[model samples]
Target: MKPLKTIIVMLLLLSISTYNCNAQDVKADVEKMHQLYIEMINNSNLENIDKLYTANASIRNSDATMINGLENIKNQYKATFDSGTFTISLETTDVSQLDDNHMFVSGTFVYSKTDEPKGVLKGEFVNTLKNVNGDWKILKSYRYLETTDNASIINSVYELFSKGDIPAVLALMDDEIVWNEAESNSLADGNPYIGPDAVLNGVFARIGERYKSFTLKDVKLHEMSNNQVLATLHYVLEMKNGKTYTIQAAHHWTLKDGKIVGFQQYADTKKLADSEKI
Candidate 1:
């Protein structure tokens, strides 16, 4: 028999060795699981869904909707594949063991349409995984899409406009958007354009026809409370009659769920009007 102190030391070393082996195993298993998910998404393999998630698993979608149960998760993935062919890549950032039978994983993912490789969306996901028998299955998952702050959203509108991407600008507006032009401004004739289509026709189209060039200059955006953004800028415009004008302008934008829901403009309308005269 070994001495008492030697026996104790051997037991301690064995325990540490066991723990280190388990840690390595869990890390490799996590990587393999994420790789499997990517393969399932890229291949649209519905048959393998059972191996990925538990029976009562739930998902909290980025849009704030909750999908419960494995059947719904399967259906959701099916719909995703039906919409378009997409390729997904997942990167596991952290994997922590919650116990001998559970794990917490956090990772980032990027998805791109197979046809449009340049258009990709990146997001983050947190997943709770349960070890059932000898397999790991996700129990609860939550995902968030890449988001822009209020000021950034408002700033992007200007950038997109500068690049002549009118459709992209309109895409950021809510379906029931309410737009208001400066009170004395000629475009205000159609005050409170009720929708994107209305604003496009009543304000944007009219401006295009009336001005040889209309551009915003020295623009600054301020993020305000209550989901509003304030933009202080100047307009550098040339009228069709060869008259040019520079005027100060301010825009107050209200957004909801990342979409522009309301807009108000404040500017020197007198100069805008005067510039129209030859």
Candidate 2:
């Protein structure tokens, strides 16, 4: 005859096997639901959105901004669709059944506009699926969408300056700014200019006093993943000496909180020195 403890151990193993099997089934079901969601969004069919999402469903943007309720979600979706023809694909990567009433799901999504079918944007998302009325629906979604285009922000500064909007240009700089000039340049004396006022007085004022005119030409901005922007352009300067010269220059900019925090200049110094005198 088998011991009583042996029987209990056998039952426990059987129960665990059963629960694992159920978990696998749940994962499969969630993936299928996501496929249908992709179809609905791609087709712009929100007529039955209520059937898909809970009334209190909310989206948490990458920036921590929340879009609450079904109406807001619908409006955002409608706006995206109106923007252009787009197709989205989501591939389920992980699913965890937190409890009988809640499941956690995560996946990567790639969305491509019709005009450029290969792919336009790719991001990952984590979603909480809740059991409401015996139906699985997204309770909360956390996803990423880049709100700050660093290149565009820097480009706007140049555009504003070209229009003689120096105040607008100064507004883009943070309260405390660190500015540096290229070695061998006269402006390098104010290396590590501490504030916007310092930059305005030490750099802009000096340039305004010494030069007849100064502007950037053929400017192109390159972005780095680490919040740095590199702008390549020609420094079109009309020296008080009455000669106009264009020197290749590059500016390395660092930004935080949508404001410029640091700047480093690289330019042809010899040309600048020769032109300064005659």
Candidate 3:
């Protein structure tokens, strides 16, 4: 009963509304896929993982192993979960809805073993998801086991230090790294060292001069949001004065572009002071 122009306008508006709704639906479905994948990995729920993939899905693991089909993927996950107690953390860096039925997602994945809390496996991954029966299911996945992000960079610093590669450790730091030593400790005399050169001169030089040996033990790195890393470690120092000290310490590192820009130290300074005179 409406005029032809009014009918055409109504149809156009309806089409636009439908397109918007479909776009929103696609985004929601893709996000759900990410959430369910993370949940399954963190919980080690292999059964649910199987359901998340298509029957003919293919996955290329970071280790270069190729797995095909839902069964094989489930078996792979089961074996991994059985081999160790671990938790997986995921962060989606980018996502694109290729079409209404397909989505592409890329993200960072980190796996931490419970027994070896300090050791972590980090990687970047891309997944192709397809809408299957109104659900987003992974059609193909590829993972690369290398990360150049802030967390990985900071972790490398500790790894280098553990290996006594001080130069390599220092190389990962910013030229103007703001290094802070724990208050009340002998090293705190420098307070905030402004540059890597200052840190090497004021902090590391002092430690080397005063201690027979200084090492970090039981180091655990936690990747937090916003380019921050938390390191829990113990400083085992043998003073040149024939005394050994073990102090619990924490380092909060802020990083940008794979370089440590800021560092703050927190420790049992009273214990450190007590050990100094002993």
TM-score for each model: 0.73, 0.57, 0.49
Q: State the lDDT of candidate 2 residue by residue for 1-278, as single tens digits.
A: 89999999999999999999998889878877887788877887776567667899999965468999999988887887787777888888899898999999998887777754322556789999999977889999998743468788799989998898887788788768889999999889989898888998999888889889998899999998778999999999998777898899999999764668999999999999977777
* lDDT winner, 1 or 2: 1
Better of 1 and 3 by lDDT: 1
TM-score of 3: 0.49
Give the lowest summed-lDDT range of ten residues in model 3.
112-121
Q: What C-alpha RMSD separates each model from the true structure?
A: 4.3, 11.0, 13.6
How well is each residue in 1-278 modelled by candidate 3, as lDDT tens digits? 89999999999999999988887777676667777877787787776875589999999986578999988888888898887777787887887888868889888988776765444678899999888878888899998976456667777787887788877777777667899998887887887898778898998777777778988889888988867999999999887777888989999999754568899999999988887776
Report how far residue 241 has shifted in candidate 3, in Å: 20
lDDT of 1 at 148: 50
lDDT of each: 0.88, 0.84, 0.82
lDDT of 1 at 99: 94
Cand. 3 Cα-lDDT = 0.82
Q: Give the TM-score of candidate 2.
A: 0.57
Of candidates 3 and 2, the better by lDDT = 2
